[model samples]
Target: MSKQADSSICAYAYCSHEQTGYEKHFFITPASLLQHVQKLDELGYFLEDITCMQVKEGFLLTYHFNRWEKPGRLALRVLVVEEDKTIDSISSIYPGALWHERECYDFFGIVFKNHPSLIPLLLPPEMEERPLLKSSEKLRDLYELLPGCEQVLHAPRDEEFGQFIKECSQKGK
Candidate 1:
């Protein structure tokens, strides 16, 4: 028989007013991050979604929960440094989270610890850059020159589009 990597565990639940009384439930601390995932087998909450957002500080892990009686589901967050963008995986909690986490990893380049399979859920094989991280002007230029450039070239010339172009141009892209 093989021994599991974890030997200790802790669990805590806290409420946040910002969650509007739904209680932003979480089982935190480094110790529990691994073992508590096993408890989820008996607890019944299933992983719903995983995504990353680029903020002023760094990428934020957003883990959504479902299949639980608790209202507002749950969101377990983990922060990573801009340089050391990685996290211990919770795949043991809900296997389905693997796909979601992989997609997040693909786009944001965050690591999921202990994930059995961590691979791209999107993006082509030949892609050389992370498209979402591109500057606004580069995005505009790419979209403006996409396959159907002719339709985009003749679309309604709204003032909002002009404003977008002006911003991109001023940003020195």
Candidate 2:
């Protein structure tokens, strides 16, 4: 793989080029999420949708972006620690992200900071608990649900993924 591809793959714990048939996925930190999205926007990538997954460590947020002209998709994954449960909103960069982020918030209880209006998109506004929050015991590991994610899951954080990839690359050398 090219260095760029290797870096992208190593950035995320559960990234897979095969998962969504996307070209690549970069696991990013919550702090860098906006910067990534902004860069993609400048590259003319449109926001497709944002999906959230509840995990043992926290909620995994995936922002799917694609370019119509080039026809390539990229998934940017960010893990928000459970206690914090928040991340910067990309709605400013991609206006479409607003609705998707709201929906994610409605179902996963993730707060998108600076979102113009982060209200419930699908459920009743009064609902207290997010319907999609699952217990860790009931939640299956990413590898179990997505084949090819086994290696990815072993390093659940972005930093760990980077270190794992670095070690693997050095060994191959």
Best by lDDT: 2
What would the per-residue lDDT of candidate 1 be over residues 33-111, giving only the tens digit for each residue? Answer: 4554454444555666777766534555656655445434445544455787778887766778788877877787778
Candidate-wise lDDT, in order:
0.52, 0.71
Give the count of colliding residue pairs in each prediction: 0, 0
Error of 2 at 162 (Å): 13
Off by over 4 Å in 1: 1-22, 25-32, 68-70, 134-173
Q: Which ten residues in a row have the lowest lDDT in candidate 1?
A: 1-10
lDDT of 2 by residue, 46-83 (tens): 88889999876677788887778766566877778889
Q: What does candidate 2 score in Cα RMSD to the true structure?
A: 7.1
How good is model 2 by TM-score? Answer: 0.74
